[model samples]
Target: MATWHRLGLRDELLARVPFSVTLERHQIAVFLHERRFTAISNICNHKGGPLCEGRVRGEFVMCPWHGWEYSVVTGKGPAGYDEEQVPSFAVEERQDGVYVQTPPVMPRKLVKHKPSHLLETHSKTPGAPPRVLGISTTAMDEANPRFSTSDALLEHAMAMARELQTDTQLIKLRTLKFQHCEGNYSKASHACTWPCAITERDPEDQLSAVYEGLVHWADVVIISTPIRWGNASSLYYKLAERLNCVQNQITIHNNMLIKRKVAGFIITGGQDNIQAVAGGMLTFWSELGFVFPPFPFIAHSRGWDAEDMQNNVRQVKASAALREASRELVERAVDFWKMLDQNRAMMDRPMERAGRKANPLVNPEDAIV
Candidate 1:
């Protein structure tokens, strides 16, 4: 049995909907709805956000940290996710004051998470070759499949990688269903956790495959994206934002999750702006600790006046030189990977950018966001 701790006068709490206070050294949030008072833990179950500081919406409270929801009355999540519940306490009001029963902290359920590829021990065989992965960010709806010139070039690049006897895998972004970045990085730099805070909260997100490939499986990564409005595909940017979680680990934890990884790009668009798109890609990947080869990217663009989309696709499909260039791009990327692999022990750790050492300041999610 637990003892009762007097909170405050009943009238004092009735004025505020969710009156928060410390009782018996435990943070509790008292809520009054339908003329009944209820108490629950003030800490969010997801990331330990201050639940008392969150706003109420109907019967549920939305967490300010990562937007997790829990009912104030039952301490349960929405339908289909009843298992995601918070701790609730028993409360009562006497003639003099309101009080809450402070019980010994109950055992929290341990979440069993799948093993992260970043922590896996890599086992190399006798003279094993480097594995290469090509990711294509060209949007083509499954219902209405269109001939993607960018995807075409990516296929050619990976095909050449296979011919060179390197183990190759191809991933098409259009084929996977993944969520967009929910602006967790804007909350705080440390809030953007590795493996993604979102991915940890919501399982079944397809971005896990990409993470595994980039972190554990591949030595060389070739990314291909089609330009949209003088930029890379929207899917590419969505994946980029999720990948910030990977780099955030480097920024705050100094783990170097992407060590000795080589990256190259293939950009194809009907309109001209390859340099702008490629520049953005290079800067973004470099910040995440990915090294590039000499002439790391290959691009194809007709011109600013190429209004006919059909002719652009037709021309790209028939160009033998473009196909040959894709092969050369893979060969050059592999050459860089081989050179770095020989002296990787000395080259890997030093490649980490200066000032990226482990940060001591703990930046919380609720720090002014």
Candidate 2:
């Protein structure tokens, strides 16, 4: 037998249309369009985003988390995605109140999507030479490039890695066209998925190259960035923000994507604050399960008042000590990676993540150890 439950007074419910009400264990979203009331499941089919909190788009509701759309009335996705539908309920407007029926008239259907290629497991090859990836986060005009202090140091580091008989690759952030992070994790912890929601949706996102290098290809990662106004470059922050998906896997799931990998840094800039920049970078990579080599970073700065950009470039290019330090940084990373490879069995154990986990959202009495 079907049961109808009163939601609220008709006028009140009309004003608060597209709101969610929990009846027993069912969460239903109520919407009012063209003087008619409709009700559907409040949970989004994509990541369980609250549909009631989403905005109405034409005849559909767009999920706030990742923009999955579904019909407000029929609870079906737009056009070709019609197969992906949410359950809809029968709604009635009485003189006294508004009511929604249990046992939805339509049933929810989900489309099975193949897992993203970035989600594939990665393993180090036995007896294979260590691979080093240099990420230059110094932004410049790619069409007509200018000399960057950070890039120069990074290039020297890559050259040293090659000389050390290790495989090497360099990625310049200025060359790649990728979108900034949309903060899906802000909506919900589970919403920030591995492989990144952006990478899954857009095939042209070049951040996949960086992800591929860090997660699958490289045994050692050396990040080079120029300090800007006492901080790391804007490009570095953009890359770091997008990398939240990587660190979040440890927070939500106990999965650590970066394991037995070594990380080092090259910091160069006209402005001061090398220690601050290196500290932040060290903390972030450490949280991602990357072990740092001793003396893991090399940096150079002209100081606060030394804003002669030309001399800054000239100094970085002309400094043999700085160049030698860059080489040494990569050498340290390669040596550390070799040690980790040799002790692969001991290092492969599950990471100890007791104090770093997010607090579970549950009643204290209902919590299980």
Candidate 3:
């Protein structure tokens, strides 16, 4: 038995070619192209983006969320991705009005994808020592390297972690080839995804190492960045932007990926504003659910006019106090993590946030507008 539901007048549908109609709990997208009417499932195959809100490019509609494209008429993906498709329906212009057939002419087809390794939320290995991860965000040429004060301190921190008998991993952002954040969140709050939209498309993106270290491997994280023009290093900001996906998980799913973890920072530069730089780092990591220990950061900076770069480098290189402070920062972070781990049950952190709330537009069904 074939069932057809009248959507609206043909002229009204033509005026609103790309629109959604929910018929008996079935949401469908209707389109007008080249004097023809076509209907397809309103939900995108990828991340359930609202297809009706997306823009039609020729015969295909590009998803507003992550730019996934599907044919408006056939609901098939472009070229090589044709096998992946959304459900398509038959639309007819009857004497009374425009009607869309129920149950779709073509069913939705999705490729069976191997889930991202970052999505695996494995419990901490029992009896295993907690891990410490150091991220050096001072960008430089790895092959023809220049000494970075921040990187040096990060090395000191890592050395301290090893001496303290904790597992340690150091990530130098300069050495890794990764893409900058492409601003998927600007498209929509739901557009930014876990594992990141860019990471899913490009396998060679090395930021996955950072994600693995922060989310799954590390109980404590130490971020080191040089002050660049009164701010954290450019590489640090780049990494921070990409990390929006991590923070967005809380806003989208109320899921905290970084619980029971601690974070500290090391900021060093000849230019001033160490406090501002450290403040930025502290605020960002806190939103990611990381707790801070006492004196959570260690920093070194000469006043703004101390632009004698060589002398500044020599000063940091010879500063035993800076090295000791770096070690102490990591120690504090590690101790905090252990303390949190020991009283994990007593702490009883809840996922339901008080001040923060999840995006109401995350669901396509509720985002009909």
Candidate 4:
């Protein structure tokens, strides 16, 4: 036999719900839906997240940790999926107030296991033949692809990397739809989580590909971006902004994610300011624990007055010298990686994270900025 416990006044219960209450050592989530009160276990079936902490959506409350939804009425999952559910309890209305019964411990339900194909890089190192990743950040319609000079150069660079028998893959940012960073770091450094809070909550985020390649797979990364208005492409910065989650791990937790990886850049534009773009990228990547090769980047700019887009396209297409230089950039990237591989023991030795010295996490609030 179970006992009923008064939670609050009936009018007040409707006003404060969906809220959480404790009864006989069991946590319960109470909600008023469709003019009736229902009680369920507050723990989410997926990760033990507090169901009352979640936002109510229609007849369901969505888990903030992974966006898994559970019905507020029956505590069941999506319709027709009776496999997962929370323990629901009996609630009654009395003249004095509303009462809820402590939910009984039900048999444990088995959660369906989901497998992932994404590879992990731990317990692996650069071998005789290196793997390279090339990222093209010039945005264009994927359905009707346009002729992009920067993308063309990036393709040439990756091909040349493969000629050296390196395993290479190209990622076109224009083909993927991923959200921009929402500046969670300003609120708190730990708020910028590793693997990102957005990616953890939203499974469809496409930036995971970039994160996996940069963190786990690649020995060398060749990024190609078309200069826009005296800076890197907007897509490049967009990707960079999302990557702040990567860097924030160092500031808050002092855990380094990127090491033993070499990065090179290829900048192309109709107008000038190539150096400024390269400089900005170098500054950011270096802070992320990446090493640069000699002449770490190469650029193709026709000065400030060369606004003839047609001529710019023709020149890059017809220039054998540019093609050869692209191949040379690949060789240099590999060579630098080989050097680092030889001295990986030294490179892997823990050093004080440079970001922490300035933005220390020891006492984040009171520390001098």
Candidate 5:
């Protein structure tokens, strides 16, 4: 049996902007949805997005980082992911305050698997090289006015990588300068050329090189950014656009270089509204042959203070969650690599024999003869 904790008065909760409570040690988010109160782990099962800070629409809580929706009542996320049902507690209203009972123990076989074509699409081979990459584009320099949470996330991720003995690289966007040449090739003849050759040095050109390197060398990537105005910083977006150029190249080559890789995101914002940015970034990464992980790390703070970096409520929570999520990412990366290895190992086996199947390529009578 679990123990119950009395949070506060029901009237006090109703007075708050969003009626919610944070489970101090558990890091869970509890909310009042209509007549019943629902409890969900604050960390998004998909990417570590803070569910408590998210908006509740009906029975679902949409992740503020990437718009990943989860059922508040059941804690079940979208299809195709292994997400355990979030534990819900019994709530009773009293004259003095609201009381919530402890959640029940999770079932051993709670997660259900879904049929997927991902394995079929990947041709099994033997001894395929294992490659995993962690790329951080957050700028930590003093030139930017606002404090960046991306830096902290990167630091935490790097620390976890070291603990797991994972090889990762940190790429700072601010240090690289590049020129962004807008308009078609007709208007801007230097579209295909580097900015350095065109006279002045453009920061965009330098940044493009870094983007190209990341896309080319990474088999699995983790991207982190600071949210600005409900979106990733201009620096990260610009880099995203440049990376699209790699996809363009693949298209030109008839998708020969289409390498499906695993990807994850980490985002931090001032006001905590990160869904828009995370959604856009995830969509962008998906278009480039990347498989998005279920969990995303989204962190926020009310205001920026020199000392706040050390003591900010949101940042501390985010940092701890990100560390755990990064560890999971490392394990998943290893699993992905092992899957590839298994696929390679199976390639040498003889193809399975089956009854003659109809071929759309030839007429039925002609094919048999």
Candidate 6:
């Protein structure tokens, strides 16, 4: 038997035609397709894609990753696998808000294993401290023609991150001589093809292993890039391609290398409008499960002219609003890291001893198991 649940208001649906909400024990995704509101589990039965983020077609929710489609009304996959139905809940629209009645069931699996450090009891506990991670891209250094405002924004972001006392990683994409694209659609073949002998000859031009390690170790990352022709510089885009490769590897192993890591964006451009660059980067972050901050600090009127960069730098240094924005971002990064630490702590407990169990498939170690 099913019961009706109050999910949200009708007005809220107007803002997000397709959105998701986590109830007492279920991750429910709501969708508005063909003038009707439908609620289904956020988890995909096949690979656990967030159905809420999927595109709403005429009558189905299309998974963004592999094109898997599910009927909104029935919560069934396109292939008609009778046993593949996702749990559906009864929903109601009242007072311009929507609500859902879910079928009580076991709690959904925790996203990741909590880190052990968070569970330790410390004497003289102080207030929660902020955690920050400064990230720098080396696209501009490579002198790629596509270098744009995003690179400059990333540089400023790194400086701000340093001011916040966060860990920092500077990634120079040109240094990584990695081969193979795996299965990226953008580039059929591997992007880097430099021979090792040549790489050794110009070791300085090689990618930095320390930086890559830091990226894997950091809790939060702030990415900066320059805009070129209303988009990220070519070097940044290439770096994005390599990052996607790493992401794919992590996914295959089921590792949580990127799980719970907060992402912030900094972009700079010649033109005042930065929507195109910011939008593209935001979309990438969202797809990767990154929690993006509310505002993206985009600096405009930046160019190759050292004078222009210096002038913009002066304005940023003088403006109180810029300072406040930096402080806010640092604070948010800290809070996000704390929450992640707590959650990781929960996962560190010995399941049998703590009276809690987890899906072995989703466990960090078991990701490769």
Q: Per-residue alpha-carbon lDDT of model 6 for 161-218, expressed as tens digits?
A: 6676765665645445643233332321121111211222344533335223433355
**lDDT (10s digit) by residue, model 5, range 234-262:** 77776765554444433332232335456
Poorest 10 consecutive residues by lDDT, candidate 6: 188-197
Model 1: per-residue Cα lDDT over 182-219, one tens digit each: 88778667657777866776777888888888888888
For each candidate, what is the lDDT?
A: 0.80, 0.87, 0.87, 0.80, 0.54, 0.54
Estimate the Cα RMSD of every predicted model relative to the unseen true structure. 4.9, 3.6, 2.5, 6.5, 23.8, 16.9
Q: Estimated TM-score per prediction? A: 0.76, 0.90, 0.92, 0.69, 0.47, 0.44
**TM-score between model 1 and native:** 0.76
Clashes of each: 0, 0, 0, 0, 22, 38
Candidate 4 deviant stretches above 4 angstroms: 1-7, 20-28, 41-43, 46-50, 53-58, 64-66, 87-110, 119-128, 140-147, 175-212, 234-258, 272-276, 279-291, 303-305, 314-325, 349-369
Compose the digit string of candidate 2's lDDT tens values, residues 125-174.
Answer: 67878999999999988889889888998999999999999988989988
Point out where model 6 deviates above 4 Å: 1-131, 138-165, 172-205, 208-211, 250-253, 296-320, 345-369
Error of 2 at 310 (Å): 3.4
lDDT of 3 at 38: 92
Worst 10 residues of 5 by lDDT: 360-369
Pairs clashing within candidate 2: none
**How many backbone overlaps does candidate 3 show?**
0
Cα lDDT of model 6 overall?
0.54
lDDT of model 5, residue 15: 64
For residues 1-369, write the lDDT of model 3, one tens digit per residue: 569998888888888778888876568988887988999889888888888989887899998888889999998999999998888998888899988998888988988788988887677778798799999999887779999899999999999999999999989888888999999888778788898998898999999989888999999999998998999999999999999999988888766787889999999989899888888888888988888999999999888999899999999999999999999989888888889989989656565456654443455434332
